[model samples]
Target: MNIQLNQLIPIPLKEKILQGSSDIWNNNVVISKGDYLKIVAPSGTGKTTLTHILWKLRTDYTGEVQYDGCNINGINAQVMASFRQQKLSVIFQDLRLFGHLTAIENIELSRIKSATPGVGAHEVLEMAETLGVSHILNQKANTCSYGEQQRVAIIRSLVQPFEILVMDEPFSHLDENNTLKAAGLIEKVCKQNNAGFVLMDLDEDSYFEYTHSLKL
Candidate 1:
């Protein structure tokens, strides 16, 4: 499960933009197996940029992101998309979902489209039940409460057979109670799947109980 970043894809920056810049991420950052890594930073601190670089979306950057000793920058878009679909899952703070689809339908969509095995409608329903969203499964995503939609989004991530879960400020919209519940669900899913997680957030305290922290 070793993840490495290698090679370099130079990104040109205007002189004005680099006027006072002294720090740049040019080297590889290795994330070990079964580790829960936290990337903490304030808003606009390049956390999302780093995530995109690692996930092979921002290939114009000055470095390459490798996973399990292979440089992914050389891979094609379809390969990268397949990797993202099967082995890597992302949960955004906005909780991206289809407005017309039901909570269960959202999860089921991921299962149906995924190349990984062991995920289906039954599994999606079970995950939703575990996250306390069984009652809202049939409800449209746009009609559900924010907290419920958040849980649904998380369950969608769980339904994928991802070895690495990259979450960007997933708990920002939840109340105190739902935050705890979501954290618990995240921990349960990660442990059950033996998956490593990369959580990006400014509030490290909220995730302290679920995973170790690493400030970037």
Candidate 2:
């Protein structure tokens, strides 16, 4: 599967984006399977908007976003839900975990939501251990630190099946060491699933051996 952006430009951001140069806005770009892509976006750019567009959470944009040649906007609700369950996953910049839920519960919710079988509870535990978040597995998400919640969100995103994982500033809360640990886990998971990912961030890093690095 591939995500092809055909001259995508957000409606609300049209005037501002038109005044600038970007490889993603108002341009055609293809993100093929197994391609690790890094999008370097400075502040005031539509980095989060691009992530939302790819995830089908935002439609206030011109042009087309296609999945395997089918325009995403044309995908019906039920089928689009299925696509999200089995093919597409995302980690938002906000680390959208349930505040009332335990860290493990948050991750388990995503794991069980998949139409296809995904990581089991034990595997989730292993992932938590790898990310140094195992200690907070039983803690309420609201009480965890930002870095801990971010790691939990990362685990949540990986517990499901996905052909392409779209991430927006997934490591903004973590230190360099934790960021690298999370990246290593993401790389391992992508390779295991033969999956690809598009990571949008503020600056460039030597993360995941990116196949394409673009400015947004």
Candidate 3:
């Protein structure tokens, strides 16, 4: 139940915005154990870039990012991939699903690749059901509506064994009702798993239930 951003991976920010001279991002934001961190920011505020840096996807950034009190930069690519598969789960705003794969297959594929225990088809299906995606379990990911796909993505993260869940603009594609529904579902799952969650969204009013927040 320990998470840390050590001295390596400094996570410094310059005047780089999506488009601006001023620094939209400040210093590094750390997620402690069992914390649900909601990052509130404007559209082009570099929230996703911060997330990518944290996940080690964009290592060219100026600072260090650590996890579990260890400097992630010291890990090799294979070790980093292993750490990511074992400890981190990310949900992109666009719902990055394999179009040709079934909803369940998308979840199962991650299980197979990572060999993460306890994430079988049945478990994934149950998670999808809890997220109101049972009926579309066998459907192609590309065929489902945006809300359904988003739910599927959430289910994928939930069933996998991960310590951290990173979501970027998770509620952007949903309507009012589905947005509320999805947020509730995500909250329930995170609490049940005792996992840390970092959600980046401009919808400040949407996530008031979060325990804590980090504003960029």
Candidate 4:
């Protein structure tokens, strides 16, 4: 599904954002299906806030956000839930995993929630192995290190079926090698599904061959 943003400026950051220039805030922009879009945002620039808004985790913002030409504000909770379960997936910066669940369990939760059939358990294992997190699949999420948790979260997001992926600083805890591995896996998944992604990061990198780049 294509995502359209029209004059979207967070109320909490309005004054500061209005005083500056941005390629996203208060601008008309379209993230079409299968497009790889990168948003470079520095600290205190509402980067996380923007991610939340797009995922419908927050609505305390001005203007409109549309999915496939339908205004998100007009969508009921049931429809929104359907969209999230089938059309959208996200890799949050904070890695919102169930602390009490095992790494594989966390991944399993997402796999079972998809409206479309998700990857099989064997495929999940293959993904974990690719990202070098297979060894920790049985470990509790809270017991894993930050990097391990991040890898688990990435696996969780990928197991689900989605048309568009939204990621926020998804590789902050990894080294160059792991980052590339994770990026490769993400790209492969998106390609296989003919999907798109919106990634917001503090700095720029050659992680993916981005179709568009915007400053926020």
The most accurate candidate by TM-score is 4
lDDT of model 3 at position 16: 44
Model 2 ranges off by over 4 Å: none
Give Cα distance to truth, residue 7, candidate 2, Å.
0.8
Sort by lDDT, best first. Answer: 4, 2, 1, 3
Sum up the clashes in candidate 2.
0
Model 3, global lDDT: 0.70
Writing each residue's lDDT as its tens digit, candidate 1 over 1-216 gives 556754333364323224433122444466664778877767755666666777666767665577766778677788777777777888877778998999888888877675555366676767777668899999999999988998898888877777788888887777777777777777777787788888888866655454556554
C-alpha root-mean-square deviation, candidate 2? 1.0
Tens digits of per-residue lDDT, candidate 4, 1-216, equal 899999999999999989999999999999887999999999989889999999888999999999989989899999998888888889999999999999999999899985565577899999999999989999999999999999999999999888999999999999999999999999999998899999999999999999999999
Q: Which residue segments of model 3 deviate by more than 4 Å?
A: 1-13, 16-24, 116-120, 206-208
Q: After superposition, how far is residue 32 of candidate 4 from its true place, in Å?
A: 1.4
User: What TM-score would each prediction reach against the true structure?
Assistant: 0.81, 0.97, 0.82, 0.98
In candidate 1 the C-alpha lDDT for residue 212 amounts to 59
Candidate 4's C-alpha runs over 4 A off are none
Comparing 2 and 3 on TM-score, the stronger one: 2
- Residues 45-160, model 3: lDDT tens digits: 66777677777777765546667667777878898787667777788877789999999888776766677553566766666666678999899999999888888887776666
Q: List the residue pairs that clash in candidate 2.
A: none
State in Å the error of residue 177, model 3: 2.7
TM-score of 2: 0.97
